[model samples]
Target: MDPEILKFKILVLGDSGTGKTSIVRRIIRDEFSLVHSATVGVDFSVKVLNIAQGLEIRLQLWDLAGQDRFNHLSRLYYKQASGVLLVCDETKPDSLDSIVKWKGELDARLQYKIPAVLLVNKTDLIDDEDEGFSEDDLEKICSRLRIGSWSRTSAKDGFGVNECIKALVWDILSDKESKTPDPLTKTKDVFDWDDDCSSSIIRLGRQDLDLANSRGRARKCCH
Candidate 1:
């Protein structure tokens, strides 16, 4: 069976120092790095995720710089974007508040709102509720911003990373199913398992002939 493969350009956005790069590094490499240097303009990477027995998706992660200076460069990468990941630092309230702007800019550029997930990163805090926005606030933000749902994630410890992204991928799949076929989706080239049956039969026949010859040689030696 030829599995279907869907490729999507997912945009990741947040204010500067909101752990956007950290989340990207964690998802892309499965390893956390302390260095959170500001992305120059845009950082691109691809991740192939298996969905079912054969279905898969290629997520093209476009990590947009959080700096206001790069705001002009944001539109350049907005084309063909199928999903979005709006991240916020759980330890920084301002960073979380800036998600609204990111959401607004994304909605403004895209013809239609694609699937989006809001992520609260750095949730290893002892008292996250007190230190940052509360769960109630996050829900309200998600509802107001038109995001489907929100999740708590710790990129440093790799908590809730894959689950959140998988949720978004599923949403993208559902969205595409309800409408026109996604241009990015295509059937994967499947191997022809039965095409070599004749070759296998020939090899087995040769093996059996060799075995008979060895048996004949043993009989001659015994005689």
Candidate 2:
């Protein structure tokens, strides 16, 4: 049997020019671009991250467009997200304030709280230590959002890139661990699968089988 690999979908959300894409690139590619075009709809990338012990998580990172025109498309990507990184440009204080809108949208779509980390990006843009948002502001955000931690990251110089991602992954893992039940206790929602959802086992099985048959016929024709 193939080795089991845990997969988690993580969403990157922020306003335009907040460096959400740059942060993802820094984490997955370890490269930075001086000028990156604004994301249109959404971009996808995968990275294998080693967390605690020998466990590894395959992160499917989705970089959502920050433009208001594409706000309608956000739900399509966030529906399957396991965690979220709410990024903001440290230099542009306004960007930090806009995190409220991003967080609201995510909450409206998700209907339940998901593990999220607040990231202040572009720390390099600040020439002095006193230029960026104050600790009081960050504390207020954390308190209002009930966020456990926040980090300042610089996508250009690769500062705190790994740390931010690792923190998010840790939160995801911790959330999963808390949700798991002990051997003696029964699961809380065992009938979750019967929640009257359209994406049931029968539907998914038939869809997969149909696709496989279609591919098999194509292969036979090629032979």
Candidate 3:
């Protein structure tokens, strides 16, 4: 049996009502609901996978609230992420435009540069008459930002969702192999909780790891 790999963190970011949570739930549970309440501060899930390299990796995926009120809280989650999934609603042009700002925020807050994947979600909602954007437009935007890869998906229909994540995991692992010193091997001390219930808190790093593992399994199974 392969030694279990330490979990890696992946942040999912997008504007409000962009189906970030829906995509995650579909991948994690193989189930989807019409009603998914807005993420309060932050939420996470975990999945584990046994891949081709004799590696068992834990993927911790983080879903940060996209409301403006939570904008200030994003950096706290972005600080030590291993990768980022920048999701956009395919039906909303402005949501797509917001990727530029998201990229800037990641650059400013992260300690180390991390790979990013762009997901144009809700493709199922697009109509034949809607010609304002195309795969070419998304490609140009991703190329400009140097995103690792881009996927056009419909979270509602489960199209391209799995392929996008699998590509991301492969890219992350490949990037680690190409580096001189493995960037992801470093681990920090776990968080210490306060004795008082009112002061209790969960560590963001731990949440990140749990989500990555869960997302990784969703990807593998989807494939």
Assess each prediction's global lDDT (C-alpha) against the native.
0.70, 0.69, 0.68
lDDT of 2 at 47: 84
lDDT of 1 by residue, 128-211 (tens): 335666666776787788887667778889766665676676567667766865543432221112333432111111122111
Cand. 3 TM to true fold: 0.77
Cα-based TM-score, every candidate: 0.77, 0.78, 0.77
Location of the lowest summed lDDT over 10 successive residues in candidate 3: 214-223
**In lDDT terms, how accurate is model 1?**
0.70
Better candidate by lDDT, 1 or 3: 1
Tens digits of lDDT, candidate 3, 121-205 = 8877766635435656766787787787777677787777766666666667656756847453322222222234221122122
lDDT of 3 at 203: 16
Candidate 2 yields a Cα-based lDDT of: 0.69
Q: List the residue pairs that clash in candidate 1.
A: none
- Cα distance off (Å), candidate 3, residue 143: 1.3
